[model samples]
Target: MTSLFPTTLFRPAAAVVAIAAALAPMVSLAAEPFVLQDIRVEGLQRTDPGTVFAALPFRVGETYTDDKAAAALRALFATGLFKDVRIEIDGKVAIVIVEERPVIQSVNFVGLKEFDKDVLIKSLRDAGIGEGLPFDKALVDRAEQEIKRQYLSRSLYGAEVVTTITPTDRNRVNVSFTMTEGDAAKIKEIRIVGTKAFGESTLKDLMDLTAGGWLTWYTKNDRYSRAKLNADLDTIRAYYLNRGYLEFAITSTQVTISPDKQDISITITVQEGQPYTVTAVRLQGEYFGREDQFRSLVTVRPGEAYQASGVAATVKAFTDLFATYGHAFARVEPRTEVDRATGQVALTLVADPQRRVYVRRIDVAGNTRTRDEVVRREFRQLESSWYDGERIKLSRDRVDRLGYFKEVAVETNEVANSPDQVDLVVNVTEKPTGNLQVGMSFSSADRLAFSASVRQDNVFGSGNYLGLELNTSKNARSLVFSTMDPYFTVDGISRSIDLFYRTSRPYNSLGDQYQISNPGGSVRFGVPFTEYDTVFFGIGLEQTNIGATAGIPNQYFDYRFRYGPRSTSLPLTIGWARDQRDSALTPTAGRYQRVNLEWSAGGDVRYLRSNLQYQQFFPIGSKLTLGLNAELGYGKGLGGRPYPVFKNFYGGGLGSVRVFEQGSLGVIDPTGAYIGGASKFNLNSELYFPVPGTGNDKSLRIFAFADMGNVWREGERLDAKSLRASAGFGLSWISPVGPLKLSWGTPLRSQPTDRIQRFQFQIGTAF
Candidate 1:
């Protein structure tokens, strides 16, 4: 008997030709065919022997030939479980030997602060390198490089990563990656060269990227990033193009890092050519037989400086108009013809309304916590309907207004093999909609106030709002519970229920003995009359108890004497509100208006109260905004009964006129207590600008404001001379906790008896 050793090992890592060449000699030596008695696999640790046998070409008692041996070798090596495979034949028996690759037992990271451990593990797993898989040294090396690359993207120039493998029991290995993440590189200098039309500083100011500044530590604008630089370049390009620099071009940009790898310098060279004026504007293309309507949307005009923004707006308007007519794939191309001698350009807009399509389906994604119906119900562009850009935009805005999602986006996708069909996908990124707040505040009137609230805007993903609040202060105390169902009915009518108990006292030197205790509950329904308007109707029952204290005001005694100490009233409310602000929290542009009317008809206290408010914001340039607000309030007696003192409108507070103490601008009683009045008017104007060194961030701003307002008793003439005026400067911050406003005002017009509080601040208030 002769024992033959193939002496050649087969591995998938090696080339097929090399593997086949090594097996050629074995095949030639085993040319004679023989029937195998038994087949046995060797060197199997973690892998089961059945796995090797399953990949073999022949079973026990089968004829094994040279071709079968070659096929078996190829088959076993393809499993990737073995690093080395060989075959031996002795006396009609076949022997199989496989050296299994070590499996990865565990993966870990050390000194990795820039990324989470799971994040790196997931990244490695995506690259076929994770625990419970066959370990490949090449894949581990690539993963180390990938980790370093991620650090570099965050401006960590000096970051280093090292991979260590430790052999464990059962032919397994544990992988460890150690990383050293250094400080991020900062932009030391940013220089713009060859700028004549605009000052270099002005051009640089338009960019979001900047050199090190006092606020850079917070904004991170000083950190060097390739993506940020590219965005800044685009901004610069747009700036020049909008200013009529039709031939403006960025010649080159150079970035250099210091030897220490902590400092970076950027240089951008731009060519500012001659400015151009529009010679003529022409429209050319299919207009769906409504050329006049499309022409009305053109903004590029002759005898004016060429503005890229105007051209872009005109193109967008044309495309959007087409989209509104079911042309979902509309395209508007603007072509420009420039004459160097005259420095004049001719602009032509070309519109192409491609195949019209109707939405075949609507899908919502990324709403892991929110229900699908909560998002679907907001859609105005229904499935199976012709595409309408305006309705789609309205739907997106409505979803955004819910304030439940951090981001909402609508994407259109063409249906496969269907030219006239499309799909609309609404993607929403949900944020935490539940908030628990416990805080302390101070004011001139409500001194040392403590408040607590628990609120959920998206309760159980039902798109309902529930909240409970408790507030206590030196002059007032209150507890309230409220709930709202935005979609109470399919018609978009909203229902709100509130139950509250409150106590109040006049802000005077006198103690809290002179107080008013009030408790009430109300249910309101909001009916949407338009896309931006809502009318509300509700009824509430309240009881006002005027305390018969030692220092009680004459007005309070008058009301109590007429309606008794405890007065019960049923008030009916009707209100309308319209909001078109770009943002409710920090509005830069748009208008808001609200009017509310309350009437108590069938109660001991019969009166009418009406309030109207209007607010508008105008954006000035890119970094400044102008805001204006006006309010008028009136309360009149009815059915031969005077207006209730508890329902009187008060002025002079953070939300009203600043500088004067809260609720102190109304009529004063002989006892020196501020008795709030029945009629009020306020006018406020503010100029807001970004904080210096903060770039274009609107979250933090500084504003100068002028406020004028006054409160008058019932039947008192509305006199301009009686209004108190103030001018002040303040800082506004949309902080993580809430919106904060701090103001220091000086009275521009005041009387000697007016109580003044110059420095004032409040949280959760926006104007």
Candidate 2:
């Protein structure tokens, strides 16, 4: 049957060629005249005759051969205005007939629930099928296929499409594509076949592709895609190669479907060749100068096993070292010699520092969404100057730091016209920077709380930020509007202004609580001290009002008598920070430090508060990273007075320590409830590793974490040695949408009153 299929497919091609040759003889045998005296078009709606005549291959009084007629037919068909085309000759005159496809009166949709109707319409228009336009069978077929693809992308694999073609009274047709989108196919089980060095569970864990999990319902990673499978295979190949399996090869990969077409299984056959150890490494060829300096850059040891990562690192280090000496055209290639019998490998690195070329022009390409200045400003290696690899890398990093583009890359191309000068092409891919968050929470006393906020990080692709946030819930009310210009001055000084109002009901489980509201605004200015550091100063004014409310905790509220609707207070704030994390979502190596101090001279709640946080990351080996974070904060009233409730820090949930209940990490009253106060300390650490089966070495990582942090009253002295602690394990996947995180933490110092949290999962998290 398989052999017959290929033969059947070739039959039509053979027949067409044979017919064309056979028909040539009949043309010679025909008695018809060869020349036309005049030409006229019989049918053409909303089309000019001059246009058709101009398109004709043969002029009037010219020979009308078979080729000419075929050309005429093809020309008319290519216009996309005709439903049918025919050329008839009578004596010496030729008649052109065309039944033009109707111009669309209007294209619209009603009750569109599956896809955005306007977006669909735009796609159809781009496909040459839309309202107020002529159409052909080819266009209709293409439109249907495109619509199906869009639906499939949305996971509507079982969707059915029906087209309706209705002719109107005015020589027009109204085309409608009605769709019945059925439910999507949910993945049941993902199985990998063939011989394996690792177990199925271990292999599965290494895959970014999953069967079904909590996020699967949304991200649909479980859905099958051939492109995704190929990418995953490359990931698997990298994993083995980096681990010293130099001879690993994937023989074949197969994706099978059941009769129902809803279930799928993937099987990959791999040849796990014997692992090799590095016996020797030799550097040959020109070293330009300072051979010792280059030798120091070598991280691969002679006796160490062959690792792809080490090989790449050596290449990069060599290249950068050459660039530092103005050798931008340098090339370094590592050739491996493998001994099959002994399973040993030898690496020889050859360096050729070619004629150094200066950059004559730096061109920005493929940036349709971003302004030219936004990208050009990040250039550190200026044109008409010698190229420096370090500068180029820094320029690329600067562009990526804007957060406007998902990916930024630089390609060096030798200018064809000029050999001594190279043209640098900066490529950028933009991502959606607008975010909307709407969520609701329910508690025993607070029936249901709702909160929503919207912000745009990259406004107009200029790298500016604007946000209008609103949070209205049971105990908290806030409205904040802010704008930030990252490049307010050409010197890189950023300025920000914030307008905000907030009202809070300081809740206490006991019957002595108070209702306090603070409403105000602020203006801040920031200065970039260095590439990894920034400092900011701000001043704000707020009016505070405090009132007693029943049902508040008596032990805390009675002592803190209500006093508010007080005069305006001048509050000052100063902040400094630096971040060097590899990834904001999951740091591999770097340090992040921040310190902020705020003080209010006048208000119902006046106090001096300071917060300091520091995070450090280190690479344990090629495959693991260790991260540590610590935070300390304290608040003290200027005069002999009580600590401000608003200055208090609450821990728990995703951002804080994840083991305890939300808002339950702070000081508690007799009822074991959170009472507003200030003074806190926290410590956390995590060890991250690549998930076993996930072919992605960088995209997915698993971590075991320990968190130790808590909040205490401001009047009470803080005991750093007595901090609360929580320990747990979690998974981190660098998903396309964001970082997907899931952790289950348990309190290390469990008290009788502490609530234990388990199986806690969060999507799109940042640390």
Candidate 3:
């Protein structure tokens, strides 16, 4: 039994009713039957008198009995509008005394970090604990328990919730909930029992859930999650089923948490059945009598180990093939017949491709931020057209590439009463596209460089990108602001605006450490030529000034003498790129090519610059990848003007010829310093392998690379024998901050005049 009154003095006098039982009399005193002359309610501040009168069982001028008194008490308590109730009869004059429950004025959350305050308020409201509602002590206690359960699901088992209530005017009160969620419980060990066919390590490798590790802090893989464990069990089942152990099963799984709730242990038991071999495969379905066409798509071969993946792949292939021809409702069913004596299985693939359907409508959903048109314009398939699976898939991928969403999926719903018509629904879940980055790094050349950037790829959900970057380095400094709209026009045309102020010093130790200051702005447009290709062209105005520094190079003084201390150029740029990579971040097999050409004809430094790059990736195995890259650059002075010294190409860095000091290749001045040249060539080959103990995580990898490149000054004869070569090993990690690369290389071919810098590490970008 719980007391209804909050005060201890009143609680002892008030009746305590058990929720599991019916209401009973609190006092033994009984009243005889009498006619009621009047009935009145008292002690209500916010509740109306009519509300109490309507709830009373006995009315005015009615005969009140003992049964009626108990009935009235039970009826009034059921309403939960009163915390205290009493009835008195003064010679046929009945009076009702009541103390109304406090009305909730506000509900607030304090010290909440794991969940948003608004979300918590909404959940409480759904549980009948909101403003203007009658507040009950029991309901408040239940709310606290529910909140604790939510934290426990997130592995925060050591969470505490405290609730407070403050009395207010008009019989109202304010409720506040404070929370403290401790650290998540982590898995200390995972043991798998009854594994005889495969090694224990091999079985564990198939699961994404693992024990504690260094990367667990970021990945949270050690946290105890029931959903993740279930998913891992499914993965294990698939692993065994794919390898001919079709009858494998997980007998039991146990999860044990430590007393302090900081460490957890997990154990799994499994059973492995006899392996089965595939005897034959046959098709048994309505394929429009095109048996031979369907047979050609089967990936499962006879006399091989029974492979569940092979059968599943063949099913998907059949379904996709049917969908291409407007059969959106096509179904493929595979039935297996086994022989215990021979340990052989025969698979019968049954498919039922229903009537061809047409798209009746296209609906977009789950995009609460982005405009509907922004998603609709990316779809290649049109409404009211025959359903095509290929275009639908491409549309989903295109939306994904926008980088505004974390997930994108397409669903087909059959139109009711219209067998030949279906509706396509596109679902997208939005993610945060705005990023504030603070970067610091140390390199051989720039000992300590600091950088910061504010970028929003989907500004205000308008599909526009805006960025501002600040770089602090003694050798190079830049302040840039840029804006780009990917869908500037209806036909997939993009527009970009860029403004930058850059200053860089020569890499050489001699020549006074003179600097070049360049301020520029450009307006560019991108036109999509095909699904995987685009062409960009831009026009920009650049102004250059030779800084006043000590020990100015004689070439700079000569250039100033000939063309003054300032030069302006109106540059025209054009570029083309075609990427067919399976993934832009970590490609295992694909081809990429890009070419850019810049020409400045209306300035004092009239020159033509062109750069080309090509890359090809090959998958050595499921876990290994090989990549080859080559780049060639050429700049020539045009219109009788010299190629700008600030625009000259340079080699001998991670991006070019590694194992040498940055920009330490090319022609030498009179002071034994290597100045940048106008011609550059580079070739790189790398073999990437998985990181040890990381399984199939592509974000972390190790690679052995061989690099060869060189630089040549303008008017200097190009020689193949002058090229510098290096071979090394490097580690790459796509960390939370950014992509990090660390390399250690030894120069294989270096001349006496070359500067060597062996170790290099960089964050936030790839070389």
TM-score of each: 0.84, 0.76, 0.79
- Candidate 3 residue-pair clash tally: 0
The better candidate by TM-score, 1 or 3, is 1
Which portions of model 3 miss their true places by more than 4 Å?
Answer: 1-143, 146-189, 212-220, 256-265, 289-293, 431-444, 447-456, 459-461, 554-558, 618-624, 672-674, 687-703, 715-720
Q: Report the lDDT tens digits of candidate 1 across residue range 1-767.
A: 11111112112355643575467446436557889998878899889888889888898888988777777777776666777777888787888877888999999888889876666666676566678888877667766776787788888999999999999888999999988888999999999999998899998998888999898888888888899899999999999898789999999999999999999999999999999999998888888789999989988789998999999999899888998999999998999999999999999998889888898999999999999999989999998899899899989988988999999999999999999999999999989999999988765456688899999999999999999999987678999999999999999999999999999866555654587899999999999999988999999999888889888888888877866899888999999999998888889999999999999976678899999999999999889999999999999989877777778888896888999988898888877888889999999999999887889999999999999999999989999999999999999999876798999999999999999999988777767
Estimate the lDDT of model 3. 0.83
CA lDDT of every candidate: 0.87, 0.73, 0.83
Q: Could you say which candidate leads in lDDT?
A: 1
Error of 3 at 264 (Å): 4.5
Report the error of model 1 at residue 171, Å. Answer: 7.5
Candidate 3 per-residue lDDT over residues 68-108, each given as its tens digit: 77767766776777787777666777777778889899998
lDDT value for candidate 2?
Answer: 0.73
lDDT of 2 by residue, 1-767 (tens): 01101112211123333443445334323435476789889887688888788878888777878766766666666565666666766777787877887887766554357876766676566555677877555557556666677666655677777777778966787887778776665556666655366676765665667776665654567777767778778877777786678988889887765555566677777777877889887888899667787888787787666888888999999999888666778899999999999888999999998878888889887777778888888778899998888999999999988888878999998888777778899998878889898876443334466777799997887878999888776677788999998888988888898888887665555534456676778888889888788999888888765554556455445445554335456789999999877777666788989999898876545679899999999998657899888888888877666666655788765656777766677777765457645877777888988665343356678899988877888667676655678889998877654577778877777667676676565555555
